[model samples]
Target: MATFAPANVLDFGGAQLIYELASAIFPAVKKMKGDYSLGQVAKLYYSFIWITSPLMFWGAYLEIRRQSDSILTKCKEKKIFFVLFFLIFSPLCTFILLNFSFESKNVDDIRVYLSFHSRLGMPVWGGIVPTSASVMAAMTAFGIRYFCCVFD
Candidate 1:
């Protein structure tokens, strides 16, 4: 009988750290209220979330399907999909975030808004970087596994 081991320590640790970071950052943003333009930008953010939700769900579906296969096969397939998906989707996400606008009464406030937009831009790159890294890592691991299987 084949037995599947549970996820390792690093995965749980990474998930915990990500959760904490997101939780801490979300409240700071939610507390902020700039102007009517900020509200508009928020609306745009919601729209992006709405549009991306389906893609994320589809990705999750692919992940589940891949997981049901042999580990080496699953890793190879997921790595390819992850790399391709992020390469295509990350720029689209950045574009949406980049074009978001907010109405402001003060020029300084507008500057702040733009600065905030620029800061928010980090998340787009951040998301892509980790995803790409993980994909490459998976590919490496799977390729090694497949090579070993060839010997066996």
Candidate 2:
């Protein structure tokens, strides 16, 4: 869950980190006439977010259920939180992707889409980065407690 924020920023915030990583993996992307543009990066980011959003909920459910003795009890307790998490980000990302104009294949032509998505995606997801940090801290503590049985 905490990962959502960073992933969001890397994908939509015009950081080009993802592009750099991709270039490293696929050397052709860095070649003379390779199709390595912000537009291609945006497409990759969009696909990544769409695929991973639902998986976050599943992973959360599995983690929550693993920690709890009773499956039904934990599901009942965390159901609303998980649902709300899915509801909020899914539509926002979808709306941003839908509204972002991806008409052209050229990097220059897709600046509009890049700018629009970045403008909206950055602040919105950036505000949640602190929350994600807190979550990571809490999850780390929970993991330590669970594994070591020191806090049980």
Candidate 3:
């Protein structure tokens, strides 16, 4: 049987790896911006999204599976709280996804967006939200699993 400690450690390590991968990709993305046409940019964006989706889903699945029993027990104990929390957070997750999709545009527009990330005149929230959302999702999953393990 797999140990929980190793699983938890791997989860965190995977998250950090993903973070570093994203950071590395940002520079390449910035370079590619304005070089490609609209259709090309759209293709690239969707390609990245498609590639990452399976990985993210697998990570989430692993997290949930790790704490399945505990989460079930917790839901049994605090069903209402779980439901309410899910209700409130679901919209936030949706908003994040919408923002991610909305940001995907023509290469020219993409260049402007990339320029914003270069520590220049950028809207604070613009640069922060995407990165923050990713970190938050990973952290949230880790936290919930930890909490479930501790409580149950």
Tell me the TM-score of each prediction against the true structure: 0.26, 0.26, 0.38
lDDT of 1 by residue, 1-152 (tens): 00121223114554345434433543323333434333323323333333343355456445644663565464455665534433345444434333342223354664444433433542343234223433433443334435443333
Instruction: Identify the candidate with maximal TM-score.
Output: 3
Q: Positional deviation of 45 in candidate 2, in angstroms?
A: 0.2
- Predicted candidate 3 versus true structure: per-residue lDDT over 1-152, tens digit per residue: 11112222313555445434543654333333333223232223333443364466557657666766776677668756554443346446735643444344443574445433322322332334344445345545544554544445
Write out the backbone clash pairs for model 3.
none
Worst 10 residues of 2 by lDDT: 27-36
Q: If ranked by lDDT, best first, what sequence of candidates would result?
A: 3, 2, 1
Q: How much lDDT does candidate 3 score?
A: 0.44
Report how far off residue 39 is in candidate 2 (Å). Answer: 3.7
The number of clashing residue pairs in model 1 is 2
Best by lDDT: 3
Give me the runs in candidate 1 sitting further than 4 Å from their true place: 1-117
